[model samples]
Target: MKKIFFTLVAMSAILVACEGKPSAATKTTEAEDSTVLVLFDGETFNGWRGYNKDHVPGKWTIEDGAIKINGGGAGEAQSAEGGDIIFDRKFKNFELELEWKVAKGSNSGIFYLAQEIEGKPIYISAPEYQILDNENHPDAKLGVNGNRQSASLYDMVAAVPQNSKPFGEWNTTKILVYKGTVVHYQNGEPVVEYHLWTPQWKELLDKSKFSAEKWPDAYELLINCGGENHEGYIGLQDHGDDVWFRNIKVKILD
Candidate 1:
């Protein structure tokens, strides 16, 4: 009886010890099961397509692990085979990260909370994170106080410090959207931040080119921003310029 009691106590203690801590495999699984979603896999266009279209435009292609947009030198007119491309999923609150590089005089943009309006351009329903060769692009000198420059809110607000690395070097970009608050990060620094569906936002829109009197359709959309559901797609603009993007990923916050 004494031997059996000691054996049972030893077994109980072992079981309790095992239950107190997780195994190595459990720890590894928890570490590996991340919430981040890769928007591009470097080889395939699995979750992307042209905005308002069923297929990716031919001007956009994967080159050397980056999404490269072949330029047509037509500015915003875009190429005959080019259009904006977006991920097929809609996210309400997320943190999107990517790296981009542009050729001399190139221009592009990253759009968030975008809606697909038939025959309407992506900028009509989305806010853009301006990407440009600030040193060579004419738009860098345009807008009110350099708002059209790289890392700006594409004319609504200017990115202070204007830390774009010229044209050829890669720059890391991050866009965080959570509960009506949006922030744009460039090269690991916070550049622009704004809130949606607020009086200040309305005031900003009213003062900008998308005002109710100037562009009523865009004003209506920008006023609401994310629509009834407050969810929208992520998009990359093909502004008829040579641009490259890679390491695109997003982490859902909602």
Candidate 2:
């Protein structure tokens, strides 16, 4: 009888301890909850703020599950009157992940810290993530010099080949920027990594078109371009080609 009573008490104590513990499933859910994708969940416009409210042009829509930018809606091709959608908030040091696919011969870009420069064009102030159909785009002919091609810094730097994936299929890309280092990744692989203020980078900038514009510290472009946003908006371009973007998300790291 005493043995039976002791067994019952021990079982009760074990049950109480188990009840206070969190299950493995609960832990996995907590980890997932910590990560948040910034892009819209569905083809619906849920997490974005329109660019230039009254001046927003073009027809921006969600088709099947992606954000589709139909050309000839409001702004002219490569013009200032086009439409742009930005995240509700701004970030400084973070990791941005998204999937994108472009149409034949089309051109567009994702700009980080893209803002207005007093005297230059809008793009001049913003750093661009080149989006294009490399096989069919004109910029591809320029070889390593053109920034207008796929994965290049839109006239600033040429993204090494390993960084760009083939066209048509969806490509997963990531941009990690922290302090003086900026790295580009394509399809989960790192292609090019550069330090912002290195002499080699500065020499390239000095010889590049950036010198003509005249900024005291040219390398400052990376830090100063996105005016109000130290970590600026994530913008998509309607390069007149049938480009599509979806599965956009971001995680801000302090």
Best by TM-score: 1
- Candidate 2 residue lDDT tens string, 1-254: 34334544653455335654445446344236454565678746775655544333445677878887776632454455455655655656667888888766667778765553344333555567778777887777664555556776666677666355556778777876655456666677655465554675566566555653565443356444445445566667665666678777776544
Clashes of 1: 0
lDDT of 2 at 144: 51
- 17-76 per-residue lDDT for model 1 (tens digits): 654343444543423546578999999999999998899989899999999988886654
Candidate 2 is scored at a TM of 0.72
| Cα lDDT listed for each candidate | 0.86, 0.61
The alpha-carbon RMSD values of the candidates against the true structure, listed in the order shown, are 12.7, 13.3
Q: Lowest-scoring 10 consecutive residues by lDDT in candidate 1?
A: 22-31
lDDT for 92 (candidate 2) = 67
lDDT of candidate model 2 versus the reference = 0.61
